[model samples]
Target: MGILKHYSGGLTREQFLFYEIRLVASLICENNSRDEIYNRIMQENLFQYPTERMIRSMTNICFKRIDSLASQMLMEHLANASTAVAKQINLYAIMRENGIVYDFMTDVIGEKMRTQQMDFSHKDINSFFDTLQEYYPAAADWSESTRAKLRQVLTRFLVECEYLDNVRSQALKPVFLFPELEEGIRQLSDETALCAFNCFC
Candidate 1:
């Protein structure tokens, strides 16, 4: 596991593809400076609802994850694919990049799935958060409101990505990466692709 970074509180708390953010990130060129990208995105009105500050955070989150070929393909699917499932994968990537807390949560979920257990409870999540706090002091200081929101995000993540039937239910749904996409992921980074497969599917 990687060293957990302090949780930044800007992650959107709903299922969002951020199509506008994707449009903005697609404009990034190899030589574009930070100011250049920001100016261009503003001029184009790529994101308007969340205020400029939130837009910038969202943009940074999506932009950083697009370096690898697998990530690039995932972005393409997220941006252009019509299916909800494809967009779900895209959202997963967004959460993976932006939600530092989710990495730990997903690891626990993956382990449970391996044992043919598909149910989860608040105590299960809280226990993971407790363990997470050992490595991330910030987790220990979260307010009740923040902790509640994080729990909501976790359930929403599973539901939106088709991993769970619903937020209130625990039965896990089967998810499989398409062969072509899986091949692209492997070609780009075998280790990452394997981890993705185990964690999600």
Candidate 2:
């Protein structure tokens, strides 16, 4: 995944969609192709989103994120692991799929963890975007509303992964990667990205 020239806004619609992702992962483990999975979801209304358009949009994001791993072991873990482990695994998958998110986790959140800076605030997010716009000029074109929504989505993602105590507190929490999940991640041969979880190489 090269540096993404344009940040995807899909997360704003659904952040760390654990249940939806688990459903998709389960289907993937069953040897379903992308089209088959999408069709199955469409037929079953598995996501229970109440609108076909919403379901399609979410499935697109989930597939993009899951396919990025390309690891059957990880997909199995995502489908069967305990909720906490599954969330972490999904977060890792998101980082793999989305360069903007990966950069934020590593450069902002991970760096904060390394430096023992427990307090995270909107200011930090703004600063990160400022730096991001410098390198990825397309990011500079995002509307304030879009930027705000992205910030909300990113914050919720960290909270869901237990990296933050809550949105209000914005306090960093210690995240322990399950051994099984860690092994699954290592299998991808991208141990460097483990730093995003505060696991220094």
Candidate 3:
């Protein structure tokens, strides 16, 4: 049985939305297949948290009648995002640069699940996540050589067209991964603030 199905009977729609919120938030830091991780997050957050089957049963009713409410989740999360993620909406730029990004990642994962009726092995699942690890160097402890290898992966992702434009832009920024946030942010600037200031003002 699907993991979400196991606990879905108990979760509220609000609670299930939280599951998705956490998945996206975590995905920004941890590079796994968003679709696979989303499924797991649903199972972990809604099914097992407060109770089982009850909230989920209620959610089914609410979602059936209020379709828009189902996707209002990202709004709730943006309300709670740290100043960091809210700094700039540059994910679109990255997605333009990268290709075949998240769309492919999710679709492939879904197809895999549909065929096997099970989630992937942890090792296999975490492989894509390593792609996002460089941004969180404290948690990642990645080597320069490792980063060189990862850049190749990133380049491949850019060549593929699955990721949305926003994700493609965000994927390459890794604002915190390159020692400090400010330094990394500077790297992404199209022109130096000083240079721009001198030109315009």
List runs of model 2 lying over 4 Å from the truth.
1-6
Q: Which has the better lDDT: candidate 1, or candidate 2?
A: 2
TM-score of each: 0.70, 0.91, 0.20
lDDT of predicted model 3: 0.32
Residue 42 alpha-carbon offset, candidate 2, angstroms: 2.1
Q: Candidate 3 lDDT, tens digit per residue, 6-35?
A: 111111122213233333444434545545
**Number of clashes in every candidate structure?**
0, 0, 27
lDDT (tens digit, per residue) of candidate 1 on 1-201 = 232233554452433545654564456534567677777776776666457876677666556544423365665665556556454555445535554534543466656655657677777677877887776777788887877777777777667667678889857665665554555545544333333344343
In model 2, what lDDT does residue 94 have?
Answer: 86
Comparing 1 and 3 on TM-score, the stronger one: 1
> What are the per-residue Cα lDDT tens digits for candidate 2 across 110-151?
888788888889999999989998777878888999889999
Models sorted by TM-score, best on top = 2, 1, 3
Global lDDT of each candidate: 0.58, 0.83, 0.32
**In model 3, what is the error at residue 152, expressed in angstroms?**
41
Model 2 residue 138 lDDT score: 77
Which segments of candidate 3 are over 4 A away from where they belong?
1-25, 46-181, 192-201
